[model samples]
Target: MAKHTTLKRGQLLKYIGKRWKNLNIISGNSFMKFLGYDGNGFADVWVEYQGRLLFLSIKEVELAV
Candidate 1:
């Protein structure tokens, strides 16, 4: 199998699942370290593709648990 590294923003993709809902991506995790967030928290969503990698909001995810 080969890997594809050509993902664009706002592109509707799907994941291989039968009992889980997908979230939207407010901002990408490629560079969250540079973009600091406030205490109030901002909108965060998960960006994934089938069996590929999944990227979500580290802030909201941590707070959720």
Candidate 2:
């Protein structure tokens, strides 16, 4: 089951903008695809978007709608 999270939209953008490695959505996809990362230690699990910081669980990403 995916875990529902409620974070401000602005925070998500902040994490992406402030963090470079955190902005990587590719590694994240691979992890979500194959089930884990090779050695990059799963991409950013939390992000700031639109003045809100959204913390998401792995399950949530896998079940993202």
Candidate 3:
């Protein structure tokens, strides 16, 4: 069984320095580094995927903790 947790801003910091499973990536599945949210009033997650970093909406990905 897999343990899944909703990606929320409150636990964003905790995900830092750790690896999480992202099941909603465009390329099937991928491992993302949680770099926390941006400071634009909206909680956007900065994820590093496939050697490239990108900003993604909180609802755009399903994170498995």
Candidate 4:
């Protein structure tokens, strides 16, 4: 089963200078700088990967490295 997480604002910030590959686990895909949590188990994350910008989810991601 895919692991899920409830990443807090502060915790999610840790991925700032990191790459999507650094994300231990991902449910959907991968960020930028401004992410908004809807308080309904979903979060919007922006990331710059492969010279492109990507929007990802929070609940569907896990960090275990």
Candidate 5:
């Protein structure tokens, strides 16, 4: 079985400036750096797959751990 957890706003804020592993499930990039909330129910993140710095918004979904 796959373990999943919901990412709350507080939790997401705590991970800012940190590398979040396994986030590639949404962008195909394994390690993503958590930036901050967009205040629009989406979390901004930096994908490591591409060299360029692009901000991607991640919707609130159950995270598979």
Candidate 6:
């Protein structure tokens, strides 16, 4: 079973530089490094897929703890 939670700016900041499961459809179930906010309502993450590093801007996705 999977659990979900929404995090505010302060709470999310703590996870920076840590790995978390990205629930966004584009990178579903892939663990990505939290890079920090872009000051434009998007979360920046480093996703490794197919031997490539992808920089993605995500909005509606749950980060599992």
Q: If scored against the real structure, what TM-score would every candidate get?
A: 0.24, 0.24, 0.48, 0.30, 0.28, 0.30
Listed per candidate, the RMSD to the true structure in angstroms reads 13.7, 12.8, 9.4, 8.6, 9.8, 9.8
Q: Is candidate 1 or candidate 4 better by lDDT?
A: 4
- lDDT for 42 in candidate 1 is 34
Show pairs that collide, candidate 3: none
Please report the TM-score between candidate 4 and the true structure.
0.30
The positional error of residue 25 in candidate 6, measured at the CA in angstroms, is: 10
Candidate 2 lands at a TM-score of 0.24
Question: In lDDT terms, which candidate is top?
Answer: 3
| lDDT comparison, 2 vs 4, better candidate | 4
Model 6, backbone clash pairs (residues 3+ apart or across chains), number:
0
lDDT of 4 by residue, 1-65 (tens): 02234444433332323445644423333322333454554555544444444556543334423
TM-score: which candidate is best? Answer: 3
lDDT per residue as tens, model 3, 1-65: 11233344333222222234653344434556666567654446776765666676655545545
Ranking 4 against 5 by TM-score, winner: 4
User: Global lDDT of each model?
Assistant: 0.33, 0.34, 0.49, 0.41, 0.36, 0.39
Residue-by-residue lDDT tens digits, candidate 1, 1-65 = 01222333444433222233553334442221212222334333344333334544433333110
Shift of residue 23 alpha carbon in model 6, Å: 15
Tell me model 6's lDDT, rounded to 2 decimals: 0.39
Q: Against the correct fold, how does model 3 do in TM-score?
A: 0.48
Question: In every candidate, how many clashes are there?
Answer: 0, 16, 0, 4, 0, 0
> Candidates 2 and 3: which is better by lDDT?
3
**Whole-model lDDT, model 1:** 0.33
In candidate 2, where is summed lDDT lowest over 10 consecutive residues? 9-18
Q: Which stretches of candidate 1 lie over 4 Å from their true place?
A: 17-65
Q: What would the TM-score be for candidate 5 when compared with the true structure?
A: 0.28
Q: What stretches of model 5 exceed 4 Å from their correct place?
A: 1-29, 43-52, 59-65
